[model samples]
Target: MKNILRLALRAIGVWATALSLFSAGGLHAQSFPSQPVRIIVAQAAGGLVDILARGYATELNRLWDQPVIVENRPGANTIIGAEAAARSAPDGHTLLLSNSATISINQFLYKKLPYDPERDFALLYNIASSAYIIVVNPSLPVNSLREFIELAKRKPGEIAYGSFGLGSSSHLETEYLSARTGIRMTHIPYKGVADVLPALARGDVQMALAGIQPAIPLLKAGKIRVLALTASVRDPLAPDVPTAAESGYPGLNLAGWFGFVAPAATPRPILDKISGDLAQISNRRDFKEKTIMRGGLVPLLQPPEQFAEYVREERARYSLLIKNLNLNLD
Candidate 1:
């Protein structure tokens, strides 16, 4: 009789525990994002990442009926914002809006990072990607990528390239090209992209790696000529320009991407919900058009697992490149 009573009590306890877990999960699924969501942008306002984050926030607000705020925490090559996001509560209320620089490149550029790129955060979704166009002053005689390469080879170190900053995506892309093609060109670092075009126009720097959106008007105005794009395919905005892959350098394909992430311990249901909403937003025609108009590529939406894998690949690629080049900012 005692043995039977003990077994019965154990069975009751198991059922009660199961019931409590299910009830808690249901409550969590139902009440998530009960307040405003905050997205920390790792750059200053008015930058490309900021623009995309604000646009997405507007759409999310419309969908969630709650304010979705974008907070700028720019500095330390995005480490500041990334660290903030990594430390936030994993309750779906806080997120990060970041670029390849923060998620991939910074880990290698900085000697020591405050957070682990892989272990500290959960990747929610990739928002959009944009390719860089190799722009040169029209005064330069080079028309094609091959011709540009020949020119650089002839004058190795004479043709200077301007990048936004040291260890920035622009700088790394240029370095990657130099490593693969054996083309040597002097690197000129600027305070920001705003300085790159001016330096190029004044002939202070003859060549640059810049995104197509900012380069388009200048190209149209005959201020700059595009030698090649960093994407595998030519940009629709500039159909005439060939990609680096088409120009006999298949390894030069690189692009800048934007994405969202939350702290790693966020619940699976919350992640799924956020990913679903983001995928829907990415597919909206207006969103696509606006992003393209602003010089961003349409986003390739992926679930959390797939996005995490992509981030891992990028992190590894940049890590190797940075280590090989001995690139360090701090």
Candidate 2:
């Protein structure tokens, strides 16, 4: 009789404890942003990532009725901001607004990093994606994707391609194109994406892989000609440009993405709340018009689970591609 009583009491205590924990998580989610929230952007001010962060911050501030700040900590190829956010308290108050490089490619490029992408962060949302286009100097005798490949093949080492930096998506994607097409081109590394297009415009480099947004003005001015987009489908922003698959290279379908991530130890309830809020904001027409489409990006927001899985796949894909490229930035 005593044993039965004790077992009943023990089960009651266990249930009570679980109920308390569940209530605590619920409270945490409801009262999240009990303090001001700050988003750390790993890019300079006025860039696409920073722009998107600020736009989301505005909506988050309105939704949470709390101050939301966007802070830029750009440097070391996004390591500075990433480390900052990773080391922050795992309370969901601090978040990272990051590009694919910080989460997917940096691990493969650097042998040692201040923060571990897989271990330190929980992906909250994938905000948007941009198309990467292959552009070349208008002076170059290439009007089509096939013509560009033929030119690169004929010229071999004589043709030069500019990238944001060594081991950047621009560089690796360009290299991927070369490897697939059996062509050779010189790689000229620049400071950032902003620099690569201008260099190509001035004929400092004959070709470049750059985002469509930044290249729009240059394209309008006839400074550069787009050969093909490294995307599977043509973006609505530039529907006339053929995708690399349509251009006969199905392997170059990578797109540039931005996402929100927080420290791994954040409570599940808080993570879910933020994810839900952001997903709602992303679907708003104002967000699509003022933030995404204006930046020449498409809204590609996904649920936290889907975002996490996508990040995992991208990390694996980049790992193999970087390995094949023999990139070891240290």
Candidate 3:
């Protein structure tokens, strides 16, 4: 009888604790972000991701009537900041403004990550995406994609390409192109975009896959020729530049995307609210124009559920591509 009573008391205690936790969670969800919110950007300031985060912070602060501060914690290919965000409380007060590197590609490129991309965070919304431009020196005598391919075939190992770094999106995409087209272009690695631009201009490298922002001014000044852009459709900013799909290379569809996320256990209502607000902001005419001017495309705003699904698809797609290409940081 004593043992029976003791077990019965323990069961009652467990039920009461569960009830209290549920009630507190409900109350916390009801009044989320009672304090200023912090957004962690996994890159250094002045980069594309940092620019987007600051812009969004301005709007988010106005909408929520609370301060939203963005903190840059760069290094380790964004794993440092990502792990910090993942370990934050699930009250929606701490958020992450992550890019393709942190959320999707890093999983396949790195041998081990401190945080699990899929398990540690809930997707809120995808803010924007941008494409890369395949640019070569104007003196190369290749103006069109077909012409470029023909020239590449003729030169083979002589046609070299430069990227920001090994295992970077540009590097992987170039490798993908080489594999698809059966052309072996020499791979030239650079420290960053700063080095890439000068190298291309000096003819130190024959060609490169660069973000549209860096290539736009150079292309317009007649310094380089744009063979094709890596987007599903032609960029309005550079409508004359054909997409890779139209250039007989439909497999070369890669774009850099940015999005927001909170800890996975965050309440659904909070995530929905953030998603809805971002959807409104992304469609504003002024916001659209600014995004275009910055060489980015305002993404088609997706609700929380749709955004989650989109990330999952991206994760799977990149995972397969990375494995097949044998891409790794080390």
Candidate 4:
């Protein structure tokens, strides 16, 4: 009788502790955003990530009836802003508009980051994605994807390609393409993708993986020719451009994506609440048409668990690719 009573007492104690924690978490979720919330963007103010952060801030502000600020901390390969977000308080108020660079590629490139990608953050959702199109100097003899590959093969290490920076998605994608096609090209590192377009037009570089929106004006002028997109499907903005898969390179369909992440220690209930709210916001037709489609990006909304898995898979994929490329920024 004594043993039975002791065991029952311990079970009751554990149950009571769990109930208290659940109640506290529920209260935290309900009372979240008691103060202003801030979203940090690791890019400049006029860039796509900043634009998305500001647009979402407006919606989030309206939804919570609280101020939502977007802060830009661009520099040092996005380490400045990402580290800030990682070290922030574990409350649900701070968010980071993270991309492939910060979440997946950085760990592989740098020997030591100020923060651990998996340990310091919990991903909320993969909000948006865009494909990089294969563009070449119009003066180049290539007019199609297959033709470009043939030219690259004919002139190994003779044709040069430009990338946004070392270890950037553009860099990795171009390298990955070379690995797939068994061709070699000189890599010219540009400060940004925007800068690469001018170089292509000037014939300083023969080819590049460029963004469609920024390349549109140059394409119209016939300065740079877009041969194919590094995507699975055609972008509405460039309906005539074939995806790499459609162009016979199914393995080259790599897209760049951005998402939201919070400090890892944030309360589970609060994380769920914020994620749920953002999922609802993402589903709105107005938000989709205005903020997402307006910028020529595709909506990639996923729940927290799904997004977490996505990040893990991407990290693993990048890890192998980076190792194969033998790239280490540090």
Q: How much lDDT does each candidate structure score?
A: 0.81, 0.85, 0.78, 0.87
Report each candidate's C-alpha RMSD, comma-separated, in the order given: 3.4, 2.8, 3.9, 2.9
> Model 1, residue 266: what's the lDDT?
83
Quick one: best lDDT, which candidate?
4
Worst 10 residues of 3 by lDDT: 291-300
- Pairs that collide in candidate 1 are none
What's model 4's lDDT at 293?
Answer: 76
Error of 1 at 276 (Å): 1.4
- Give me the overall lDDT of model 3: 0.78
Local lDDT at 56 for model 2: 91
TM-score of each: 0.83, 0.86, 0.79, 0.86
The list of candidate 4 runs beyond 4 A from truth reads 1-20, 139-141, 158-160, 190-206, 221-223
Local accuracy of candidate 4 as per-residue lDDT tens digits, 212-280: 776888899988999999887889989999999888888887777889999999989999999999999
Stretches of model 2 off by over 4 angstroms after superposition: 1-21
Clashes of each: 0, 0, 0, 0
**Taking the tens digit of each residue's C-alpha lDDT, what string does model 2 give over 193-275?**
66677788999999988777778889999999998888777877688999988988788876778999999999899999999
- Residue 21 CA displacement from its true place in model 2, Å: 4.3
Residue 95's lDDT in candidate 1: 88
Over the stretch 70-99, how does candidate 3's per-residue lDDT look in tens digits?
A: 998776667888999999988888999877
